[model samples]
Each structure stands twice: as C-alpha cells, then as structure tokens.
Target: MTTIARSEVLLCEARFYAFHGVMPQERKVGAEYTVSVTVGYDYAKAAESDEVDDTLNYAELYELVKHEMQQPSKLLEHVALRMGEAIFQKWSQAAYADIRVMKNNPPMGAACAGAGVNLHLVNDKTKKC
Candidate 1:
C-alpha cells in the first residue's frame, strides 16, 4: 500500500501597486493589486523534520510573485497565469499552484469593489492548456 503525501501553502491577499489594465489611464496611473497564491507539495518530510529546507519558503514565493507583477500585463488573467507558471518553474517540487490577481476599484462606471482572475496549474506538462 502507498500513501499520498499532500499539503498546501497559502499566501493570501499580498498587495502591490501595478499597471495592468486595458485603459490607458489605468496603465499610466496604475492600481492596487491583490495576489493570492496556493502551492501544493509533499509535506510529509517537512512535517516530520520540522525544517525550513524541507518545505516551500513563503518569502521566496512572494518574491517570485512580486517579480512577475513588476512586469506589466494588459489583463489580470495573464498576470495570474504568468505568476502560476513562474512559481512552478522556480519551484520544481510544487505539484500544483493556484494564483489569483485582483484589481481594486476597477473603472467600470459602476460602484464595484474590484476585478480579478484565478488560475489553476498542475505540474504535468502534458495537462497544460
């Protein structure tokens, strides 16, 4: 019998000021973005060892997201996708990644909170879309 070791690390609502939108004003003035990332990996070793090296580092993950955010994108979807991909690329041990990018106070004429996009990614190369 075999047991699957699964665990997820979540970074919630990390905020940043970035330029990512279709409107020119939005691109110039920029807007506040909130990014939430979930990383899945085997946690058995980390749990047993209780060492930082045995698990994913949250700071490193944040840096990766920050790097991606610095590069402007026209759409939240693109930013989310890129962040997911970058995380997976940087951390080969990550089995899955979920990224969400939210734009605060979207200028849609209506009194709206924000706009966002969520991206889910798996390590399987053949399964990517």
Candidate 2:
C-alpha cells in the first residue's frame, strides 16, 4: 500500500487594525483583528531536501493574508473565506487551507470578547487524488 504523508504550516494570531463592520463607529474608528491560517501539503520533498524552495514559504503566505485583509469587507466570514481561496490559488500544491478572522471588542452593547469566523477549503486536485 502507498501512503501519502501530509503536514501543516500554520500562522497563528496575526494581528491587524482595519475598518470592517456594519456599524458607523467601526468603519470610522476601525478595530483590531486577529487572523490565523493553516495550510496542508505533502511533506516528503521538503522533509528530505531541507530547503526553503522545496516547501511553501511562510513569508509569502503572510503577504497574501495581509493583502486580503487590506481589502474592506463587511463580514468576517467573507474575509476568512477569501483568504482560504487565495491561499489555494497561490499554492497549488496545498491540499487544504483553514482560515480564521476575529474582531476584537465589538460594539454589541454588552460585555463580549469578540466575534469571528472560520473557513476550511480543500483543493480540487487534491480531492481527485
């Protein structure tokens, strides 16, 4: 039997300040956001080669996330989903991507920590294989 080895690269709690919300104050004053991303890919080549080129570069991933975050979106869910899709589009070798976006101290008229959304996407090619 042939077994496929898989591994994950994660960027956790990447913080950002941006204007994204339905509320007027939120759009004007802006808010802090926390984003996390996980990307899954085959481990064999990178493990054996021990070379940066053999694997997904984390810096590039961060850049992609940052670019997506800069675009204003009313919903965290939209942001998260777009990030996941963008990751897959950039890294064709990636098997899966999971993205999360969080808004801190939202104005809900109560003591609420935050609101967030998570999105998980699988590569179409990976699904076929």
Candidate 3:
C-alpha cells in the first residue's frame, strides 16, 4: 500500500518598488509593494528524493512574480491574476495558487498599512473548453 501526501510552497512578503497604480505620480515615482504566493503541489517525491528538481523551485517562482511586477498595471487584481496564471502555466504540477499583491501607504486619504488584492486560481485539467 502507498500513502499520498499533499504540500504547498510559499513565497511570502516579497518587497518590490514598481509602478502599479492608476495615478500619474504612481507610475512616475513608483511605490513599495509586497507580493505573496502560495502554490499547492505534491512534494512526496522531493521529500524522499532530496533533489531540488523534484520540487517546485521557489527561486523560479520569485522570478515569475518579479517579472509580472515589472509590467505596470492600473489594478492590483490584474497583477495578482497574472501572477497566478504564470505559475500555473509554468508548472503543470501545480494544483492551485493563491496570490496577493499589496501597495503600501496607498494614496486613498487614509492612514493604513497597505491595500491590494488577493486572487485564487485552480487548475482544472478535466474542464473542457
């Protein structure tokens, strides 16, 4: 008999400075942003194989997020969604992904830590087009 295992890879609180807002100053001056990503996958092989190739490469994941952040967007939702899609497209083993994008000290006339969007995506291999 064999047992199945479920696991997740997380890239948390990655900080970046980029242009990602709907204002002129935001695009010109850029702002501090934080991005977090969670990817669901089965890591049972890597746990035993002890090989980096057996599991999702977190460094690569960071690169994906960094690439998406470089492309300026007017909405955090757009950024988050793109990140999620990139993860799924790159790694077919990914079952699902949760992405969060936050902008620190938003210009919305309020004293707050940050404001942004969270996006969840599922890979439906059985879904027919």
Candidate 4:
C-alpha cells in the first residue's frame, strides 16, 4: 500500500498597517491588520534530507503576504483571496492554502477585539493527483 504524506507550514500573527476598508478615512489613515497563513505540502523529502531547499521557505511566504497587504482593498476577503492565489502561484508544491486577515478595532460600534475574513483554497493540480 502507498501512503500519502502531508505537512503544513504556518505563518502566524504577522502584523501590518494597510489601507483596506469601505471608508474613505480608512483608505487614507490605514489600519492595523493581522494576517495568518497556512500552507499544506509534501514535506517527506525535507523530513529525511533535513534541507531547507526540500521544503517551502516561510520567509518567501511572508513576502507574498506583505505584498498583498500593501495593496489597498475594500474588503478583507479580497486581501485573503489574493494572498491564497499568490501562494499557489509561487509554490506549485503547495497542496492547499488557508489564510486569515484581521482588522483591529473596526469603525463599527461594537465591543470586540476585531473583525476579519478567513479563506481556504485547494490547489487544482493537487486535486488531480
């Protein structure tokens, strides 16, 4: 029997200040945002070889997220979707991507820590396999 191995690399609580909201003030002043990303891939070779090249480079992943954050979006969903698409585009080895973007202390009159969006996507190539 053949067994499939799955592994994930996570980048958590990455904070950024970006313009992403429906309000004009938000676009001008920007807001604090927290982003988290999870990438699923086959790390069997890395586990055995103990080489960075054999696995996904998390630093690169952060760069991708940072790039997306720099672009102004009206909704958190758009930010998260772009981040996920960027991941799959750069790393074909990635089987799936889970992304979350949070806006702190939103304008809405509510007693809450934050509001945000979560996006999960599976690679089309991986589905074929």
Candidate 5:
C-alpha cells in the first residue's frame, strides 16, 4: 500500500541583491533585485507521514536562491532562467518552476528606466507535460 500527496510551493517577490548587467559599470555597481519563485511537486507521501523532512523546506529553498542571486550575470533573464535550473537541481521532485528577477533602477542610458526579465521552466524528468 502506498499513500500519495501533492503540495504547491509559491514564493512571491522574494527580494535579494545581485550584480548582473551587460556593461562592466553595471556589474561593478550592484542593484537591488527582486525574485519571484514558484515550485510545485508531489508531496503526497511526505504529507502522509506528517514529517517536516518529507516536504520541501522553504528555508533551504530561500538559501539556494539567495546564493544564486549573488552570482553575477550578464542578463537578468539568464539569472532568472538559471535560478529555475538551480531549484530543479536542488529538488529533483519539482515539476514546475517560474522565476522572475527584477532590477530596480536599471542602467538604460535614457533608453528606458528600470528593466528586468522573467523565465518559466519545467522539470523533464518524467515528461509529464
């Protein structure tokens, strides 16, 4: 006999600091970054046991994101997309992941004000979708 359960994890607007930009000036001058992450997976079995270890620990997840955010990148999109990959690597059971990284007061050179990027990724372990 096997018991099953599922849980959807949603973390909206998780804030952090990242040095990501195309120009050297931008990288040298860091900016405030906002991260929105969502991870979904099957936690049926973990739920049944009523154990904290059975389900995804948000604390650990946050740590991983924070670490990735510190890594400098050329583009926010790259940061966002890679963040999804990091999450998947940390949690193999995660089926769906969406990431959004926002840079406050971006250096647009008058072309634009603030700019950011978003990315959505899905684990292809089972090809569920």
Candidate 6:
C-alpha cells in the first residue's frame, strides 16, 4: 500500500547515443542509443514561456545521460536508475525523476535485431520539505 497525490511536476525527455549492454560485443561495438527522462518540478509558469531559463533544457539532460552511458556498466537498468538519482542530487529544485535507457540492437549471438531494455527509475524527493 502507498499514498501519493496526483502530483504534477516539471518534466523533460531527451534521447542519447551510446554503447551499453551486458555482452562484450555489445559494449565494444557501439550503436545508437536512446534514453528518456522525466523530471518533476513546479514550473507551470516556465512551461508557458518556453524560455531557456524558464524551463529545463532537455539538451543538458541529454548530455548528462550521454556521459553516464559512457561509463562502463554491467546493466543498462543500473545506469538508468543511477541517472535518476544523479539528476535529483545534482540539480536544484528537482523534486523527483525517472529515466529509461535502451540499447537499440543487442548482440544475442544471432544475426537478428531486436529492441533492448526499457527501464524505469524514480528518485525520491526530500521528505523534509
């Protein structure tokens, strides 16, 4: 059991290109990657302006994920989850966050292609406030 309101917060999503996978070949042979991130904030006014300072620049978020992906990792799921935590810890005014990273084509010891991991992450907001 849990309790949470229909809370609304600022959100943003961006795509990144990186090499992340469980297999060695997958890590060595890089491919285009995509990550989606959702941030929670109370930026209702900023959403309307569409200004750089007014709203969260998804470009920056992309860079953050891109950098995180570059670091060696055994599981994309871990990378995705860490990203959410990093964002909240690094960025100010960010109440919560979610991230999903996926490898476009994974080496399954076959000459076929398929979709990769689609993970979800949630960073907790400070309970104090």
Candidate 3 stretches greater than 4 Å from native: 1-5, 126-129
TM-score of each: 0.89, 0.89, 0.92, 0.93, 0.83, 0.67
- Tens digit of per-residue lDDT, candidate 5, span 8-98: 7777778776678889987897888777787887777566898868877778878888988988999887777777888888888788887
lDDT of 6 at 105: 57
TM-score, cand. 4: 0.93
Candidate 2 at 34: error in angstroms?
Answer: 0.5
Candidate 6: segments with Cα more than 4 A from true spot: 1-16, 45-51, 109-114, 118-120, 127-129
Model 2, 1-129: lDDT tens digits are: 555555888899999998888877787788999999989977667777999888888889999999988888888888888888888888888888888898988788767777888888888878722
User: Residue 116 of model 6: what lDDT?
Assistant: 48
Model 1, 1-129: lDDT tens per residue? 556545788899999999888988888999998899998877677778999888888998899999989998888888888888887787777888988888988888868777898888888743432
Runs in model 2 lying further than 4 Å from the true structure: 1-4
Error of 1 at 98 (Å): 1.0
Give the lDDT of residue 54 in candidate 6. 70
What TM-score does structure 6 among the candidates reach?
0.67
Task: Tell me, by lDDT, which candidate is best.
Answer: 4
lDDT of 3 by residue, 14-123 (tens): 99999989998898899999999999988889888999999999999999999999999998999998898788888877888989899999989999999999888887
Instruction: For model 4, state the Cα shift of residue 106 in Å.
Output: 0.9
What clash pairs does model 4 have? none
Task: For each candidate in the order shown, give its overall lDDT on alpha carbons.
Answer: 0.85, 0.84, 0.89, 0.90, 0.78, 0.62
